[model samples]
Target: MDINMKKILLLGMGLSSVFLLSACSWIQPLPGAFNVALLEEKDVTGCTKLGTTTSSVLSHVGLYDRDTAAIKKDLILLAKNEAVNMRGDTIVAISPLQDGRMEFAIYDCVK
Candidate 1:
């Protein structure tokens, strides 16, 4: 390979490595994790239904692999954050969407 071609190849590889490393921490859990109850439909009797919310994780690049477990964990945390924002005590009837997203039915329960 010529000198110019070799330099281009090395730059491409360096950039690829950087992207891969950066993607590793994309789904990290929150510090001092807040507790948001995850409840079933039957368990929502005394709770007041607030509203529905959704969260999603998108792949950074086509070359990157999807981490389902991490995505799920992040989605749960996202829902919990939303619950906190809405001043709700629990999340009920949680469902996974066809895309890399989670749907949450939020509720404010009697504590």
Candidate 2:
């Protein structure tokens, strides 16, 4: 292949790989941290409304104070052990906070 063509191909592959890595990070648990279903007060629009993954998980977990507390505790534990990894639900809560956007998901230790 021509030098110009080869350079373009390499650049394209490098860019694509970065994008893929970021996407993969979203699904995978953050290294050395437990995933949490963080429900910010702003996320709830109504009794049935859920604005984000964190909010939804909080809602599904119900509006009980003790339950929420325990959930948080478990989440912390996972993070401490590097075992806090989940996809969506199942473990019901597997989220890691990066930036300001909160995420809610399952602690998919299996993955």
Candidate 3:
């Protein structure tokens, strides 16, 4: 490869890395989101169902795949934030992560 071509390729790779890393930080826990509890269906007994929430984030940056753990973590945070919006204090995953999306059941189980 020519020197110019090499420089361009390296720059592209560096930019892609930056974009992927920055994307991870784009999802933040909203107020009260951290207080929301993640529980299993068995533990949500007697809790009032407040509907469900689905969260989706970037699963890939261009051709490179993002970290699965980071994607799952962001998905959880997004779900918790949605749960808080529905006046729910707890959440239970209703579906596994797929296509960077996951479903969660929100419940008001504070009582």
Off by over 4 Å in 3: 1-23
Tens digits of lDDT, candidate 2, 6-88? 99999899867654443332233455443333343443323232222442222121222223443445443443333333232
The candidate maximizing TM-score is 3
* RMSD values, in order shown: 4.3, 15.3, 2.9
Worst 10 residues of 2 by lDDT: 55-64
lDDT of 3 by residue, 45-98 (tens): 999999998899988877667788888889999999999888899999999999
The alpha-carbon lDDT assigned to residue 105 of candidate 3 equals 98
Whole-model lDDT values for every prediction: 0.73, 0.38, 0.89
For model 2 the local lDDT of residue 58 reads 26
Tell me the deviation in Å of residue 69 in model 3.
0.7
TM-score of each: 0.66, 0.30, 0.83
Backbone collision tally, model 1:
0
Q: Is candidate 1 or candidate 3 better by lDDT?
A: 3
